[model samples]
Target chain A: MAVWLRSLRYAAILLAFTTSAYAESDPIGYVKTHAGAAFVDAGGETLEAFPGLALREGDVIRTGDDGRLGLTLLDNTVMSVGPNAELVVEEYLFRPGEGELGLGVRLLRGTMQFISGVIAKLRPEAVKVRTTTGTIGVRGTRFLVKVED
Target chain B: MAQRSGMHGGNLLLAALVAGLAVSACAPKSWVVLLPNEDGSTGRIIVSGPEGQAEVAEAGTAASLDTAVPETFDVSRGEIDTTFGDALQAQPSPPAVFRLYFELGGTQLTPESAALLQDVLNEVGARPGADLSIVGHTDTAGAAADNEALGLERAHFVRDRIIAAGLKLDRISTESHGEGNLLVPTADDVSEPRNRRVEIVVR
Candidate 1:
């Protein structure tokens, strides 16, 4: 009975590991540009931001005082952040065939430029950029925003 | 009494200066500005805050984010560059999309589309850290389920060619829109050549 229980525990652990790994492998975007000290916190792992870094939902992008970073989503949305910035892609859903589209981001501090993409064009109401003090509703366009400390 | 009145006037001036400084300090620190699209078209944005809401439709206009009531104001180019130069400079190249049409009811590309394959490969090679999305779409002929599978097959064909040209398989995604999303809307069982195409977006 003891050996069986141990085997069961091992199986459970293996299943959990595979599930999490699969989730992490599914990327929604890729980092295309970076300079200075940039990082991406993905699935509890802090990775140095570099070109071709895959980005997943719930990822937090941070830049040091001199850092800058740019990335493009699968839906073709482009975003870049200036120094001393913290941004998070809180939500993203771009399955167009089933009529699902949403892009939500939160800027904790600093500056960012956002260019809308297919998701914004398909469903303008579903796209939003939020700061601590305000929320922006994008209507298929490019814009710049800054949040001061 | 005149001397005392003069002192009072001086105090009033000092008080006014203090008030002005306070107002300046309390000015909005967080804001958003609209920019014209690459195609020269300006779109709109609605900024909502705890206090009120404001809409900015015109390019080069801005709205304060932390103010009691959102207000629109003109933003000069100098201010924009000074504030957003780094962010703008870091922006990646915009995504490019190409459509390749297929022969009737098959995964084989038409002669013209086959000639365009080299251009597609060249585009993929030009970008650093590039990723692609290839969605296959089909005309509204045959059953929807069969069309969906055919679309997948068509997408796979393009994906294979791209991978053979040196791009990593993980960097590409394939999907089938089937007849559900027709480029040229038509009745069921219609054979629309324009709809039988695969769209590849290189980002």
Candidate 2:
């Protein structure tokens, strides 16, 4: 009976730990609105900012004065966009011990720069950045991308 | 006869002497005249003195004494530019002393950050007629456009918060430089807290 009770106790502790850990990675603020042009890390490739490019973990975003931008994933992958860029944060997760880490980014227009980070390293498949071209995957360790029309 | 002959001869000698003295008294005195030579002409001279007459030729031109003299006059002209243009071109300003902060990947205001904002606001409000520009910046973690927008949003957010706390909106303007004006450069793997901030430029 004592052995069974110890097992139950362990399970309860594990449940509590899981719930609390989930709470920490919540976003404090989000991408309100980016004017002109912007860029996002769409799956693995970079998306030029148009209307709704979102932000995700391990995503690096940049904008030019005339509206150019570059987006990079956490692993140092890159995506460059041109003038009047805008981006949005669609989905993101960075909870420890959850065994799951994902990030999503969308580019509206302009330029972008994306660099990979924790999420891309821990869960390579979970990382993605969306752009006008489509969702890009972080296959190579580091890369540069530019989109314009 | 002898006495008469002597008288006649003496009378004749006296007459001759008188006549010679009269001729000497009638002659005019002579004067020496010297004239300066003109052009290539030669000089002529006359001597009335007992010595005799001699003429001297012209000497060469006199030399100037300007090389030995030093300047005595001093003058100053043109004014220095105290306006913004010259100062901006010659010397760009260093980064501001205080900065604005945000919660990680989010816009939520933490108690520590709230207190910091209050301090900045108080510092600003305490001084009247202090026009300020609230510049926002972000780290290299996000996309460039996103970072630019993020920077601008952060700046505007702070501006709104300060205005909500009784500060004048008219006294402040917002500028988002994004990651273009980074305080510290960071590697692709690391997240630098210093670069993720807002600056209050008090003018």
Candidate with maximal DockQ: 1
| Two-chain complex of model 1, DockQ on C-alpha atoms against the true structure | 0.77
lDDT of each: 0.89, 0.46
Q: Which stretches of candidate 1 lie over 4 Å from their true place?
A: A1-25, B1-27
Which whole-number lDDT from 0 to 100 does residue A113 have in model 2?
36
Per-residue CA lDDT of model 1 for A105-143, tens digit only, reads 999998999999999999999999999889999998999
lDDT: worst 10-residue window of model 2 chain B: B74-83
Model 2 scores a TM of 0.30
lDDT tens digits, residues B1-203, model 2?
00112235556556545544543442121111111222334332111122232222222111111112111111111101111111112111111246767765555555677788877777656543334568888887867788888888888888888788676555566778887777888864346677778878543
- Model 2 achieves a DockQ score of 0.01
